[model samples]
Target chain A: MIDSIKYKIQICCGTMCYIMGGAELHLLNDHLPSNLKDKVSIEGIPCIGKCDTKEKHHPCVKINGEELNNATSQKIVKQLLTLENNDLL
Target chain B: MTYYNNAVITKHELLVRLIQLLDTNKLLDDIDRIPLEMRPRTNSPIRCCVHKDRAVIKYKLMALLGFNIADEQHELTPLKEYAEQALEGYTQNGNFLTVVDEACSSCVQVNYTVSNLCQGCEGRPCQVNCPKDAIMVLNGKANIDHQKCVNCGICQKACPFHAIAYLPVPCEESCPVKAIRKNADGIEEIDFDKCIHCGKCMTACPFGAISEKSQILNLFNNIKHKKEKTVAMVAPAILSQFKASSAQILNSIKAVGFDEVMEVAEGANMTTDHETNELLERLNSGATFMTTSCCPSYIEFSEKHAPELKPFISDTPSPMAYTAMLAKKRFPEHKAVFIGPCLAKRTEVYQNQNIDYVITTEELGAVFAALKFDLVKTDDSPIVSKVVRPESRGYAASGGVTNAIKTILSSEHNITTELIDGIDKKSIRLLRSLPNKKVTDASFYEVMACDGGCINGPVNVSPLKVSQNKLKKAIQEIQSEEAAV
Candidate 1:
């Protein structure tokens, strides 16, 4: 079996997101399945430097490539489902 | 974007970067260039210019390195100098909280302003309720003369349309003990004697002027000295934090150079058992009511705001203290560093001879990142399961202490428990009211300054609900694993 997951998820660990919801999102590392774990490279970035831009709702996350503002644990988990269920990786 | 992202995360990322540099032995050469490189001249300015932003970052790095700004005067010395001073083994002071005076917004201290929403009504109740006659209607709107205003706040109540608003300085309004007040220069200063070190103001400040003095460099230096084994005492609240299993977290901690990870919950089990016995003895011995002193901030509150209740507080050392004592006892050659989500734990450990250091979950997260330990790829927490009872594990949440005490105290004792989930002005007042010598009907009061206890502590990087769920799952897994035996 071979698994090559190329997802690079960067969650904003910036203070605004930290205070708003980024702190909660840091827990994302503990929830993903082990199979998906090998594929996804998750990191808490200093910040994407986009906080408060366009009055953005924070605890933002970049999944694969697209940034999702106002992200929650459930939303992130849902996005990870596809990557996790795949055994082919 | 708001400066908050830059204000808060910039400091943390910078600290992590410093640690990463140190891990790679590049600290001395590359550290100074961090702010400069991050805010390069070509980049649009965060402040008036990149140079100004870099200047603020320098003072911030100083604080992060556990040194206060050379105090209200003298141009800042270079980051290299502070790094040298830290390496020269300047021990940290008891004053753990410090304010960057330059960052202070020096916001005007005023209360109950009449806004444009103020209806220029003929009734003029704002004027009528103003005892100082501070209110005057002009330009078809109510205006408050700041000099004449006593801040009585009567006009706020008098306004029918709620046009009058109360503007509170973030740091001043959030301090439960009123320890922070502005100096003549308008920069906020903390009265250390009154300050509880709860760190509410740290999160409340928009300017991020408030900061905890760092001890990470000191810890690394301690490890460098090789005086003793570096024992990591993991708090009960830490089990499910950061989405890492207890095994992974423990191994990751070991991966960071800790000789071993001792469950603070093991000490908590002892604490819970000992505290319960103390409560039963106190209640049976005809004490009217006893308070749990496990929370250092609660102890500070009792000593400062409610000295009358000092006699009622249990003399038992807190879980952190007890764990440090136990850790020291078990391994005489060990230097215990408590890892928890509490900021007050810093103040608590500074006085404790047994505890060598106090690092928060946020700080530990930085260290983990600096070392680049990926829990997703690492093994689960290498902890021996069932080493701690499930009840003691409940120490992470509010009411957990009372529940643990209740498990030990017989129902025949007829103990009435009062649980205070959060401490604020109102709760402090309520605590003060207990000493009236009036007809009282309580055996124990469990007070957690932070709502949801240590899980919701000031510096915990995880969400409470998520942490709680993980805690619940971990406890169940422990119980079931034992059942499998």
Candidate 2:
């Protein structure tokens, strides 16, 4: 059943995350390998409120409760590909 | 100017009256009657329509002045030119069209639904619950008949499909300023008088119905001046939006030709320091209570609806104004451009001589896209250790200013403080009622018109709820060292 499949992609649409261009993160869905898109559900939440440092590193999104600090579309795609292959390569 | 008092008309009521008057008078048809000023080659109908609307407004103003539009003339300037110029002058003078729209939207749309749904049961839940008996159930469901409905949306919240729907002009509905309104024809009109030129309506309108006049080409032409120094002061809220590290963001801004990247958060620090002192001074002087003067919209509301409340306004400049002033002082010859999620700052730039231009976050995004800045691709490390107070950064959220002020008061003295954020027009009345002379729990007041504060400012890109959270987290993350600054 489609309902049985539990694939999660957490999207951060928080103010800070958005300033980090989180609104544009939705565009990453197109880059996903089609199989993952259906299995995945993306939800935009208010700020996860992490990355309190001034190092230009925060306003991040969490995928499956694991925080992804460098959350660019490219980094996100690579992370997804790794998830799909089930290999560290 | 002879000012007549009429129960101190709320800005919102004035807006409704203006809209009702236009509808009653069929002003839209007359707006269509005025001709475009452009010779032979005509401008777009939309552009001409705006001019025509201006003409009619001018005619009305003239009538108010007892100078007939047809009769007023001089040798060098024709009546048409005079009218257009006068309308333009009127716009330049205090109009607060956006505030009127906001008040109108909060009142009219809400009043309509409340009026319809109101069931005049013997035991009225709405009336009983209303802190102020602003609601009266006339027929069957709760009818929010005018002079009663405070546009609190409390009744709507209390009601069982979110039935209380407030409608205003599309731009007005969308505008953070509440500047746009509908004429008799259902066409949207701007109160250039009240517009701070934040351009939120331009993005909010699905129909592309509202727009700001483009100064891009003018900017490009001015860019030819090799000796001219152009500086872009970015808001701290932008830290979360860009792809690069903080330092890289600065570098990227430099790459875009800005001489230096200064954080508006620094200005926030200055404002916090000054505002704290001002609040303390007010308390010490026995000035029963005071309200923050940071948000331009809040300031505008006080000017219109509660002029008596003006004495309570803090004299401290807003972060944007403070930052621009400092920037102008640092690089006296440089042109300063402030970029943020505020539509009202456009008016700030014109009103204050320290700044040259104001661009919204969306406009800044466009600038990035146009420049083809591959932000994600860049590996530049961002400058991470910029010192700004955590409390100051929290100023991005609603009631944030009050919280920051309260923190200062608590740290320095034993005086009590009270904070009210995310309050609309109705709540202001409640707050006004709470102010007592002798003894009160809260001595200081912090109220933001928009719920969730500046981050949720009408011009912001992120949703209000989301922005509020992000700001909360951001504040949590602020280092104690940084918070001190």
Candidate 3:
């Protein structure tokens, strides 16, 4: 049986993140591959405070509670697919 | 950052770094390390090599320090020296833009090229339609002769196979007034006399070759030294720039060490009254039509490109001008800073002395990033002014000005308006021809240099659709609150 649990994707919508490209990440749902469309859920949350880190990973995203740095829509989709493929193993 | 291209992200990062250095008081000591730090040996170079990228960054830093690249006296002058000069109150020499020749890609002059897909067909439509006789069929393939080609693009359209491609220099193509062009070295040069400071070319350049001299350091120095009580005159467009509420944004401006915050929408209300009276006077005097005089870029366009329409431009002060005047009256000794989404506003501030400094919404964002001000968590407070009308807040959008005036004049006078949504080559031609046209259908004209208005200004961070929806919601909320009151 395929793992049917939906992966929670939290996108930072803070001012810094919004300006630094988080605005485009909101459209990740439309760009996601058909297979992963039902496998993930996306939510825009207030600043996760990760952008203030020493590395300044702006437009940060959290996928299934794991932090992703400099997250783009494509990067998020790729990460989601990778996660799903690993779950199959 | 994906919303903006790579170049804009780099520019913003550079700004954030510069502001951080300024805040830490390590600007002069560590300024030279920025270029090296940003492009280290480990990182792949964006240009020919790491050294070239460093050179471009150095010149960009010079521009950010409020000096034109032309002001560089020698090759050995370090970035530290420029920082020192900037700290010592080096004012810009009235030029708003500087082109870093090092960053310029030096695009080819030839515009039209025949692709391999060309069939060299029997029809020879390209050769037949060439107005300048610039197309010649050699070796059974159509070729564009650069020497004779006038770039009219007639041949490209006539090609049946779409084999002809028109290559454009983005900056040159985007400029509405033809202010930016390649010089003898093929590097883009801005002609200040022709420049309206609209900043379309700045946004169009993918290489980020064009730099606007920032007054961020100057404003920072003033705030740091406590030279005077600094007052921020926030534009209405700023309401939708971030995900936070309008009240939170204003409160955050206060949290950024601004002693006071004044909404420019208050002045927009003033502008509505004054401009409406001016329009009424013009119509009573048998004037054909009058145009709104709020957009600084449009004003510059009229003075330089469309001189014939000068008589029709209203003489009333802009919202910024009115706000600055009010600030002067309210707090005579306060340093007034106009925070808005405009490059032309810098030039406007320069001409209008009441406004001590001007910074774009992007620069303000950089300041927030440098100070680590989380606007989402900022405390909300009541807006500074209660007199701001719903129509005044609408001034941030394209037809907002006309709509505001229409609300007042529609009852008494039959007012028709023409909105020049954004200034482009096509809109410019229409604006130029307006004076010569005998028939006038519109009584009032609303012209905004940026498409969709100030919310979509070149320096604005948020996307158009997002900002528009947010602005619409904010305006509606304000409308309901006013109705309840």
Candidate 4:
């Protein structure tokens, strides 16, 4: 069996999020470090209801459940870099 | 219960069984979401264009065992290598124009909003209220000058008779943008400049007049050449349509020509994880009320009518978009087509660089018919699995969002979450009527614009009311199974 878990990033694909640029949310796959490309999984979602709170602040996404704001490919890459560094640490 | 052993069941056979179970109630629900008035009575599975915007299609094909497969996008494996193929050999129009005619007669107007303004002024309130001075006195009645009148309904409101009416344009009314208009011939005309390609109007039109230029012939030619593998990502609501378990649905889709079948629901499960984290952070950082941007129509509405709310839209990919990434990751060599009950998905797929094509249930049926292949009668010798995450299955209905959030928060801190679906003025009124402002009470809220969830999408094969009941049954069945397990 193939190990489904590796280096993967999941994104919410809910309609609300897609309109906020969720449709192209996984464009970040291009920005992944070449060494980690095979391990990375960028995905979308329907609705998680996280941003559905009374006070919604977004362009919101998560990497392994760690929240990131002003999410873009570049910002996500940096977060991954820190995770890689922490694994060594 | 028509029970077929999983080991012997082909995906097509499974699908045939499912389709037979889909009666008028289910068909009505599907038609309601798709906004289809008159669909074809094809000998095989039926497919047709849902006239809302830019001619997006809805398809319901007979799958293995008489199951119904409804998809917004078709399998795109055949279209990957258009450069090397002869397009003429494979091109065939299913008398596309004829399908549109049958639909026009039965198309009923869906009143999203009605004219509340009756220009109550004495000097023909429509003329007095006309901002452009476009109204003229013709035969002592208000007549709008075509050149100067901007189609703004101020005159309609000003008229006491409420005689000045905003007649529903068969094709252009459902457009997310004000892109569609009438030409000199009274036929619908699309303005590319303002068109966002949402395809809502394609599903809205009664005449089946608005349609997308065909890329099917090119796709068929590519398949003949065999350039890439086609993978189809089906939406969660579709799972309810199948009489058998989810695994059988996967097998049927595979039988339809998909190399691999994956659930878009997994994306829903993952989104819950991503969005919840985002919510916690945003709340800590100090932001006021936030609205969901998941529904494409709502998002487009905010962009055109409520741009101020853009910042509030949570940045998350739709389940389909998320699943597309997973498919690409798992099978990098394959081109993906999303199959579901949504016309907006056509525009969403076109706009997204990752996805290849979006064919509705109607288009899928057309493709199956074109091949003279009956998915229901196909041999049932395919591998299938029954495993689906509870969260994944829960993503099908309107309140599925709330359930996922609730499950996630069950073990966590005490954050209050409230789910709101079928959001309209009435729902807003209920929220406002609360004693101490209910909107502030919940840590999270899920709102779906449609009265029923996506099962009633503009491209589904079931009715909203029946789908709602089915949704309840499916959910309860799942819950009881979980409890028993």
DockQ of each two-chain model: 0.12, 0.06, 0.41, 0.01
Worst 10 residues of 2 chain B by lDDT: B1-10
Model 4: per-residue Cα lDDT over B65-112, one tens digit each: 111122114544121122123233222221111122222333323221
> Which lDDT tens digits does candidate 3 get at residues B1-485?
11468788778878888888888888888889989888888888888899999999998888878787678788899988888777666675567888988889997688888999899999999998888888888888998888898988888899999999988898998898999999988899999999999989889999999999888887887687676798899999988787777888999999888898999999999999999999999888888888899999999989888889999899999999999989999988898999999999888888888988888888888788778777878897665777888889899999999989888886758888899999998988878877777767788999999999999988888778778877886688678777888
Tens-digit lDDT string for candidate 2 (B225-264): 3445877788766544443444555566667667766778
Query: lDDT per prediction?
Result: 0.76, 0.54, 0.85, 0.50
Better of 1 and 4 by DockQ: 1
Candidate 1 regions off by >4 Å? A1-22, A26-89, B1-7, B38-52, B70-73, B88-90, B114-129, B135-143, B157-163, B221-228, B384-386
Compared with the real two-chain complex, what DockQ does model 4 have? 0.01
The sequence of per-residue lDDT tens digits that candidate 3 reaches over residues A13-84 is 776777677776776777899988887888877888865523668989999889898998889988888888
Candidate 1, residue B324: lDDT = 86
Q: CA lDDT of B266 in candidate 2?
A: 77
Decreasing DockQ order of the candidates: 3, 1, 2, 4
Off by over 4 Å in 4: A1-89, B1-166, B175-177, B183-187, B191-198, B213-225, B240-246, B290-293, B299-307, B351-353, B368-387, B411-451, B469-485
- Candidate number of the best DockQ: 3
Please list the Cα RMSD from the true structure of every candidate, rounded to 1 decimal place: 7.0, 14.1, 3.5, 22.1
**On residues A10-38, what C-alpha lDDT tens digit does candidate 1 reach at each position?**
88755445545576676677777666677
Q: By TM-score, is 2 or 3 better?
A: 3
In angstroms, the error of model 4 at B367 is 3.5
